[model samples]
Target: MVFFNKVGKVALGSRLRLMTAIITDDAAKVYELYEADFMPKWFPVFYTLTEEREITITEIANEIGHSQPSVSKIVQEMITAGLVNDNLKTTDKRRNIVALTEKGLILSKKIKLQCIDVEAAVESLISESNHNLWAALEEWEFLLEQKSLFKRVNEQKKMRESQDVQIIEYTPEYQEAFKALNEEWISTYFEMEEADYKALDNPKEYILDKGGKILVALYKNEPVGVCALIKMNDENYDFEMAKMAVSPKAQGKSIGWLLGEAIVKNAKELGASKLYLESNTILKPAINLYHKLGFEKVSGLATPYKRCNIQMELIIK
Candidate 1:
């Protein structure tokens, strides 16, 4: 179709809205044909009133999965149409209870009859179509609940932007870039401890010379992120993934993720069994990224940094 060919999949919201308008327009005509004065937007609220003889505005909103203000507006519209009443107070006297008027009860009989035909007609339409749109809609709702479209699109955006990033091993010329990146993030969150300075100031002696490895992420030939795998002689864990930092300018480009992933792959190639990491709960985004990289919380470990309140481990082997 020209619509899809022109706008592509990004027009999905507009397409769905157009189809919904068409369906609701048909619904309004059906109500008119039955001589039941009703608006299509009022069906959800009206149907809930028939099921619950008396309900508060908040209760109606919960039942219909709508905003409280929206339900209140609908209630006011129904009240003006002389089809509903909301003058009674709840037992607590804090909320107004709503119910259908005598005129609404008469119109309910007509709507019930109209619904029977509408259901059959909808079923027939579905059976004749190539897709089971009802089931598909339910599945779409379920998937969206699991992961929203916003997060999904952001993931895609990050992945695309990260393609421009290049992960490279440590080089002498890039030492300042690595130090400045780590210091920027550390000083922003917490004061740098002696252990941080020992590692950052002398990576060659403290990390690389001690059998550790550092990786740098370069975007457009400029260093944007850094991560190090400090070799550990522990019986359980083989390496401590530490000092991960990304430039603020490159925050949303997945530079941290790419640097962390490179460190993991570097560890696996070095015959490491597990990778340990220490972080603070205050860095929620970093903690979430660690979890996404398969790190699980673990206890019973000693740390040098006061900011290290949480420990996590990833088993590679």
Candidate 2:
């Protein structure tokens, strides 16, 4: 036995391999002690054929969770040892079926009795363990089937980064993204008006060229939300927060909060003393977000869109 005390803990892969090697070597030694010609590596295929009577190489591979090539190699060795025979299917010459020979059947019966000893030894080892290792292994296999280990790890990574939303300034590459994101919500809630088209289609001319800024939220390097800070021509340093939209797929992931915080920061940086927005009361979530960001409800404000029934403003210090 190798001591891993210096290493402190053994890796999962190494531990599993070591356990398999130890059991295989012990089984091989038992077979040798009994003066049997069979090997431990041959048991899976030999025992399966003995019970199944006749089966194809592919079937054996599938039943035993081994590669077809590996199973085929073992079958070949069995054939060379005169323990099994292979015959081509009469209806399909391409397919070959395998069956145990007389010698194989006799050897299988002897091995069956030996397996009782192996099972007793395994049970004794399990009794010495602090916990039920077999039960733990079964539960682990079930979970792997439900969701693979790789997928579970990726989901954990996504959950951790869900709060880490990133905001980026709009560029020529994101031109289509800005338009698509805005149009998705606008077209869904209400019909797109002429003003909507002008702003969504030509953001550079209407927003950027007029000293306004557009910010896009990025999650995993993909544009998922957008908002624009439009400079108002009024004497006061006030800006209109417009065209805020988060992709439906990314709605519940806090991308909207990130975009809202970013647009406010950008507005303050651009010398704005107040930020105003025009929205519909039907948009309860958006309205709630605005309220959470300290935007106060205000009375009368002129809005070009017919959908604007609610107006709010935030004072920037």
Candidate 3:
């Protein structure tokens, strides 16, 4: 998300158009959209699915066009809220088939019906007062508009938002870049130790070995953020998140939140029910970010890493 200054000789009048305006949609709204637009109403007809019949995370993921892990995480939430259940499985029982609970079935039906009415009401408004509706919105945007302050803040945020960070499988060429990230955090923030070459074990390998994933956030040549999923527990849908570290240079740039969101989305893709994180109280902002992103605290200790002074877990599904 580097900003470039262009050399130009214009006669004091130049206007630059933005490529794309940012769309800020929070997790809850996204969840609501997913629940309202799809689910029982659509799924029943689309896939011949029903609350009574057995279902699998893979099937739902396919229907939703989302990663399997991400879909699993959502299913876990449904299960936790008693909207879904482990009602059936193959003879081995290792192959679990998810099913909707009574609550989920009822809630989806209610929402589907209510939103239908809401949309009808909105349509009536449009049919009755089209001009006033749009004009009111336009006047609101105009009245709410501030000058450079808003633009400056948004531009500053863009310094991190539109970065080209992506998921890459670990490789030797990437190994150095990986170790560079590790070496950057060698002792203090990166797992209490550091090494090079032979002793340098890239953390992503460990995470990958656990049926999870690794996603690296890159800014052109430099790696800025890294998150990994490590297998943790078998209870409450198993596996916890570990080895989440962002570059010091990228602090306050939303790198952590991006990584956090990535982990959640990735967890859902992986079919996880819950996500737990361990951190120290020293990282207040990190804790706040976790809370903002929907992680909650627990009474008893919940992590193996003693260095993790505070542990926060989120039921992803």
Candidate 4:
């Protein structure tokens, strides 16, 4: 939900965003996908087949963006394989009329079914992503595509254009932005009462005294998001999990997930077996994210607190 640097220069950390795709022609599974959908359900790319008219081999190659020789070879292979018919009367007899055989039509239908399977595979990988994540990916991809294709931007040039986000130990240097974003977030979205906002700003020092790690997300030189990790030492309290809060300005752009990912990755680096989080059910989007990241439910595990209304945990390997 970032809207900060519009028409202005931004920092490095603000520029790096991640996109995920399940269907990549570059992967080995591409063959699997191809096998799934090689047959045409009205093959939009092939005009003659759709119109039941004759078209030259060159026309198909141009439509599919393949070389003429390669298209001819594939057509020849399909004819021999009985998946297509290429022998037909044309305005010119030497030129063949191309159409799918009965076998090819059946295979095309089968492929359409397998494309459904490909979609299932994609859904499984990310679990169930939120609408926000999917929508953000779509918008971001279009922006990046415009820059890469039309702007003729190179990889290194794009890197230089990206923001410089740093994930480090949280210190007093970040308290201002942290406090500012949190207060603004409460005021803007949650309509949080004065008591709730005050309580958040005045979190107990004892909680911070433990193994709390602060992660500050900066766009170029400005602070955009902040996450805190409070380690539970058995001396004070036994069970523990990570804690995070992001700014309203940075709400919908997956900054929270960025912060969450950094915290989880660090948890693995620190060798924590199970990472827990405490949040109110009122924050439905955040809760849904925990589910997407493989976190399940537990009762009464939340501690060090008064702010949380619900509890969730993730077991990290």
Judged by whole-model lDDT over C-alpha atoms, candidate 2 comes out at 0.87
Candidate 1: 10-residue stretch with minimal lDDT: 87-96
Per-model lDDT: 0.93, 0.87, 0.61, 0.61
Q: Model 4 misses residue 290 by how many Å?
A: 1.6
| Candidate 3 error regions (>4 Å) | 1-156, 159-161, 167-169, 179-183, 189-205, 299-302
TM values, all candidates: 0.93, 0.55, 0.46, 0.43
Model 4: lDDT equals 0.61
Best-performing candidate as measured by TM-score: 1
After TM-score superposition, what is the CA distance of residue 179 in candidate 4 from its true location, in Å? 2.0
- List the candidate 2 regions with Cα displacement exceeding 4 Å: 1-10, 88-95, 160-164, 167-215, 218-317
lDDT of 1 by residue, 133-248 (tens): 99999999999999999999999999899999999999888889889999999999999899999998999999999899999999988899999999887889999999999999
Error of 2 at 115 (Å): 0.9
Per-residue lDDT of candidate 2, residues 15-96 (tens digit): 7788899888888889987667987899899989988988999999999999999999999999999999999445777778
RMSD of 3: 23.1
Tens-digit lDDT string for candidate 3 (140-251): 5576575444575676676656465554444456555555665576465545433233223745455566576666776665677776666765566456665566778866
Give candidates' CA RMSD values in order: 1.8, 11.5, 23.1, 17.7
TM-score between candidate 3 and the true structure = 0.46
Model 3: colliding residue pairs: 68-269, 69-268, 69-269, 69-270, 69-271, 70-268, 70-269, 73-317, 77-317, 83-101
Per-residue CA lDDT of model 4 for 241-306, tens digit only, reads 443566555554566666778878877786777777777777788788788777787775535445
Candidate 4 wrongly placed segments (more than 4 Å): 1-164, 187-208, 233-243, 302-307
* Model 1 residue 149 CA deviation in Å: 1.4
